[model samples]
Target: MQTYPIPMVPGPVVVPEAIRQVYLEPYGSGDLEVEFVELVTRTQRRLKAIFGTRDDIVIQSGEGMLVLWSALKSCLVPGDRVLAVATGVFGYGIGEMAQSIGAEVKTLGFSYDETINDMARIEAAIAEFKPRMITAVHCETPSGTLNPLEELGRLKHAYRVPLFYVDTVAGAGGVPVLADDWHIDLCLGGSQKCLSAPPDISFLSVSPKAWEIIDAVGYVGYDALKPFQHAVENRYFPYTPSWQGVAALYAAAGLLLDEGLENSFNRHDAVARFCRRRLVEMGIDLFPAPGAVPSPTVTAARIPQGFTWEAWDRRLRAEGLVVAGSYGPLAGKVFRLGHMGSQADKELVTQALEVIAATLK
Candidate 1:
């Protein structure tokens, strides 16, 4: 496999050596050790801090999508109603995932380059649709967009929606995701995006109301959340745990907290601003539509006018810089520079931008 000096992808980013080393050290069996359970408990506590919620945190062994599916299945039975607010690939995709599970879904979609800025329209849907659950993505990574949820939280309560779900897989540590304050019942996040950890761990902050619905649904599967409720306290997990994975997650969360969440947010914001300014100075067009909030974790730009994505990607790779291409409707038309977690450093972004400039010239 080839590696690049300037490594910037949306996720599964270059894991720092501090986190990489945890995988090498030896430990007792995950299923038998009490110490492992303690590690999970501590990790859960640390994640609660990151999520800014007093709710219980469930740390499961898998990449982010595992919990996304689990959360929907655990809470919804066939014929349940879901209102999915969408702005990009992941946003619209979540709505389809719900439909696949036999739920009746209504997708409130914006352009791929847009965001969920029209809350009045969303509120009307909630008032009329009165769905059982409302789903949204906090950061639409593919489009480099961020949707404000505070008002939706207000709508969730005002309309008495039973479950308000969100996927903050790309924004949690890079930006603010106030789960409790926003009244989000099932707030989903991953280890890879801003935590600088391996993509082996996934977590969610489950509110009491969501848990109640989960219990009543009685869904049982590998991704099920019910077994996890007391799995930690009883020293028996749903499956064999990954002690190294959990420890790396624990360490990763600590790294962000040590830096201070607000400080981290500011760093990501500054770097994003710098990246966009440099791109504009080079005459490159950004992808986010007018009025859409660009994500601090990533910057999406249109492919150079005369260059196809394939050619542009090859040129950058030849220069030893790596970035990501967009998905769905954005494929080939847009590209991204992920500046979150360890890669959020301003110097790193400057270097990445330099490569883009040189390639453009």
Candidate 2:
């Protein structure tokens, strides 16, 4: 087998010792694996600590997309309009999912290079459309922009019309997301990005407000189809969970908690800032707007006119470094470096930048 130097790909970067220990533990469906239940509990508890939410949490056995699709199906009703703020590929996927379930979807969007629609604009759209649900992505990884969660929360509370659902798949644990404080009804997260876990588990923390609305609507009679409480109660998924994947998620969750949320966030922020600084110093231009909110987990840079992103990417790989290609509108024009997962720290970022600098020269 050929040995590779360093992997800077977006996910599955590296797993911590504590996380590895949890993965190595044996499994059983009996009382011996009762500790496995603890894994689930601890994962949720740690999430609550980070999200600052006491709301009900559900750990699903799939990627972030699974949770996103499930939440829309379970909550959104036929003919109900959903206000989707599109900024990237995943944002568009949310609208498509809502429409598949008979939702009258209306998108309030911007170009991939642009940031989110302003809160004032969102408020006006809400008043005009009177949508029953609002979907927003906290961090648009493809563009490296952070949406204003607090502002969105305030607008939702004021309108009191729609349920606010946030997709924080790349933002959670790395950025500040106060689910309870923001009064967001639904929030989804993934383990692979910021949590540094194997890519198998996704989680959602459902607010009481959402539960109340769900209970009042009272079973539309299709309990089997719902994703929130449905899959959990049934235990077998709509299909079987990756048992080993769950173990990995639990281990990763434990490691995140041990480092502590504040510390984790600070470390990520430092690395991102360092990366941005180095890129600018290397005469590279960032894609995101200056003075605007930026994603702490990923940084996107526009390739210089004479240099194609692929050429630079290939050169970096030859020097034993790896990064990601942009998605959708950004493809071929920009390259992204993820400052999340186990490698989301100063040491990893510094080394990665060093390799990039050598490649550029």
Candidate 3:
């Protein structure tokens, strides 16, 4: 059997050995049905706690993009205006999804090296477009920029925008995101990122106001959130749910809670600081401009002037370390180092940096 390299990529992070054991157990049978239901219930509650929201939460059987698409489909109808804030690849992706669903999409873009920190510009766009819904990515993983979502959330409330959708897929566990405090109507996250679980499971939290809008739209399908709503309300699986994924996520959540959310955030903060310090000591430049808030979960740095990411990345992998490269405008300019969940440990960060320094040399 081939052993996987230490996963330091931005997502599908290294799962804890204890959590991986959950996968070895057989799927729930008739005798274990109630136990499985309780597990799901506990997972949902813990997810809401992690999100810092009391809103209805759903665990879906797909990647984070599924929850993002479901939010757009459930709330937006033809002719509705959507003002999407694009700071990086995933931010631009929100506008693309909105447009694909036939909503009139307007984007407020920022340079890949900066975050959308200007509330004035976002507010101006909202005023000019009069959008029914607004989308923002809390952390643009590609750029390693963390947008000011609290201010934007407050802005949305001030504008009386019916819905505020946020992609916190890369932010939630590593940083602080109070969905209720920020007035975020719809917030989505994935088990793969920061949560330290395997891929194929995503979760979302929906506020009552957003639920009202979703109900009015009345869309129903495999991708719709309606079935998830029914599942939550009726306490049953909407379809054949992924019990293994749920269990894994549940175990991960328990670990986070046991560690304490504040401590986890602090740990991520320390890891990010350590990584940046090491990079600077090596005479490397970070991707985000000065004054731009970097993501606590990942760090994006420019590749050395003469070294291409393809060759450097391959070299690092040969040394048994795995990092990520950028996409979109940053494809060749930058590479990403993820410091979240299990990979956020000091030993991992130090080892990855050692591999990086050697590869670059």
Model 2 C-alpha lDDT per residue in residues 1-361, reported as the tens digit of each score: 5333666666645666766666666676622354555655666687787667998787777677777876777677789889998877778778888998899999988667666757778889988998888998988888887777787778888888658999998888788889988878889888888888876788888876677666555434322123445543333344445556677776676677778888888988888889899999998889987656777888888876677877877788788778887877778888888888677877878888898777777
Best by TM-score: 1
Q: Which stretches of candidate 1 lie over 4 Å from their true place?
A: none
What lDDT does model 1 reach? 0.93
User: Which candidate tops lDDT?
Assistant: 1
Candidates' lDDT values, in order? 0.93, 0.76, 0.88
Model 1, 1-361: lDDT tens per residue?
9999999998987799999999998986775888888888899888998888999999888999998999999999999999999989999999999999999999998898887777889988998998999999999999999999999999998899999999999999999988999999999999999999999999999999988999999999999999999888888888987788899999999999999999999999999999999999999999998788999999999999889999999999999999999999999999999998999989989989999999898
Clashing pairs in 1: none
Q: For model 3, how does the per-residue alpha-carbon lDDT over 1-361 read when each residue is reduced to its tens digit? A: 4344656888878888988998998885721477777778889899999999999898888998889998999999999999998888988989999999899999998887888777888889988899999999999999988988888888889999989999999998899989998998899999988889888899999999888888899988777887777664466665777888899999999999999999999999999999999999998999999989999999999988777888877777889888889998889889898898888898889988898788767
Candidate 3: residue pairs that collide: none
| Candidate 3 CA-lDDT value | 0.88
**Models sorted by TM-score, best on top:** 1, 3, 2
Error of 2 at 290 (Å): 2.4
RMSD of each: 0.8, 3.0, 1.7
* RMSD of candidate 3 to true structure, Å: 1.7
